[model samples]
Target: MSLANLSRIARAEGDPKVLQTGRSSLPTADRVARSLGWFSIALGLTELFAPGAIARTLGLDGRKGLVRAYGAREIGAGVVSLSTERSLGLWSRVAGDALDLATLAPALGRDNPKRRAAALAFTLVAGVALIDVVAAGSATAVHARAPNRRRNYRDRSGFPQGVAAARGAAAALRAHDDLATARRLPAGSEAKAPAVG
Candidate 1:
């Protein structure tokens, strides 16, 4: 069976059916943010699992713990990016990229044997940082609310009748319920009845 058919099998009778599937309706910036989130998670896993390898490759000797810490940070940012708070996550990633650059700068020293690798890593991080900045700005702009916009809900009362009428109906319903409860009780239950406000 098709994917939609499979989904339909699990749905209730009155649930809306899926007619077809297509590209996501998310905005371009949001899509980018999502992609970055996945990237962050993958990279974080790598760093978390192989901090020693990463430290050796970058010539940041004895910093395995730090690399692991950064990995945790990446995973946290990734989770946020994949959630409704994409802008916040992207901004956090930009901050992380700055930290990565600072940490890698020391690895570029003349005495470091992996200076070239460090430079390459630094360049890649800088590029990703630029993308993060762009994605964050775009996402923020796309999700920002208009300052002067005001919502008009003058015609809505959330009930078929007006508010006052709805309140009166609710009181009548409550009174009816109380009467029904009284009828369901034993003869002397009124003496032990709970007080109502």
Candidate 2:
């Protein structure tokens, strides 16, 4: 099956909202990116509201402004992700995740009371970054492909749609062949005389 079909089936099975609303479907990777987008928004809200606390937790003594700046970046990424095409938004999130890791990396080695907490946060952020990379890659690939062609149930161009259609097409083709053969024979000759029962 095409990636689009697989994503549709997966979403239909997993998301109750899809069933209830009967809304248009999105690809699986796009769904993943949307989830990440929500996550970014939540995380940004936390950081923007509690920058001082987050800075302390990460072993930063007076970097509340930096934390808030990063929070703004997260919020921007989240907004872009939610509003834009999957590939671009997802890749932007990946970039934001990279920036987050870069900002947090120094705390891992610092001599501070929250060193362990910083380490744990670093690990969690790294794991999330991995997910962002994966979702970004999948979205990139899905977006790179051509749009899907809808299946035509009543396809009629002499191509088989089902067993019945196949049989009907084949019969029509055979009759056409018979007529062509008769037209090519001598006027007095019966084309099927040799094959008569």
Candidate 3:
């Protein structure tokens, strides 16, 4: 089945009243994740640049351990940034990826000209990413309130049809109840006849 249909089913079954909430919950979560991911990158970079000093200060192997840990962090940050779906989330991802690139830059400058140049290039690209994500978040926000966001898509697959049917069933039930309530009501609200014995 199409992804849209699956989403509809999951939402309807999960929460029938899902449409009631507003869209004010996107920014904070993405920001927090971004901050943590960047911090991971910063720490990784520190370890890379002064693995021995850092390790000795903290009581661990400095160079090899630092490289391994920081490399792992960089890769992990890249994955998280890539996977996040929200535009704000994407920004966080960008920030994280940039942070990793910055960490790589100093290591490149240590000795090997090739590695140094590569790190510098990555740092530049990562800076661009920061700008990209900020714009993406704003773009998504504008897109959300464009007044016609829902009119673009027509082929809703099978799930929307199923939801329509379920809505039909529910509306029919409500109408029946309304009619029953009307029949059983007194004509005047002030006074009612005694129940028939």
Candidate 4:
């Protein structure tokens, strides 16, 4: 079935039907940031569940705990990126990239057999860091309000004639209803009947 038809499965009776769909209005930076967020979560789950493998590959044999901690951090950043705070999340990923680079630096030494792997990991992270920086900046620019701008709504009102006039008209209608009810009741029955206003 088509996506529109599939969407109808969860809708209740009387709910508005989807006639069509179109492209998302999300900015390019935001779209990239969202993809990065999912990437972060996936990487985090891997690191969290297999920290030993990551540490060994990076020549950090005894630092499985630290790798696991980084995994958790990735997951948190990913969640924030996918949320309304996309810029914040992208910036966080940039910071995490710095940490990853620092952690991998020692593994690039000649003594470590996995130095080649660590170097490759560092290069990959640096590239991702560049992307994160660009996405963060773009997203921030796209969502920011104009400087020194202020909204003015003093001239607008729901009632065309003004609030006081609307209130007066409502009061008059209530009074007319009360008078008509009184006339329809038997004399001295006003106290027995419920109030109209």
Kindly list the per-residue Cα lDDT of model 2 for residues 1-197, writing each as its tens digit: 55555568557565643224345578888788889889989999999999999998788879999889888888888887787576676778778778888877888775677889888888898899899889889978877855697667575655437666655332322333476775665543544344332
Error of 2 at 3 (Å): 27
**lDDT tens readout by residue for model 1, 62-160:** 999999999999999999999999999999999999999999999999999999999999999999999999999999999999889989999888987
The TM-score values for the models, in the order shown, are: 0.76, 0.61, 0.31, 0.76
The digit string of per-residue lDDT tens for model 4 on 39-142 reads: 99999999999999999888999999999999999999999999999999999999999999998998999999999999999999999999999999999999
Compute the lDDT for candidate 4.
Answer: 0.88
Instruction: Give the better candidate number (3 or 4) by TM-score.
Output: 4
Error at 90, model 2, angstroms: 1.7
- The all-Cα superposition gives candidate 3 an RMSD in Å to the true structure of 14.9
lDDT-better candidate, 2 vs 3: 2
The TM-score ranking, best first, is 1, 4, 2, 3
Best by lDDT: 1
Question: Residue-pair clashes per candidate, as listed?
Answer: 0, 0, 2, 0
Candidate 2 is scored at a TM of: 0.61
C-alpha positional error of residue 103 in candidate 4 after TM-score superposition, expressed in Å: 0.8
Instruction: Name the TM-score of candidate 4.
Output: 0.76
Error of 2 at 141 (Å): 1.3
**Which stretches in model 4 have alpha-carbon errors above 4 Å?**
11-20, 157-197
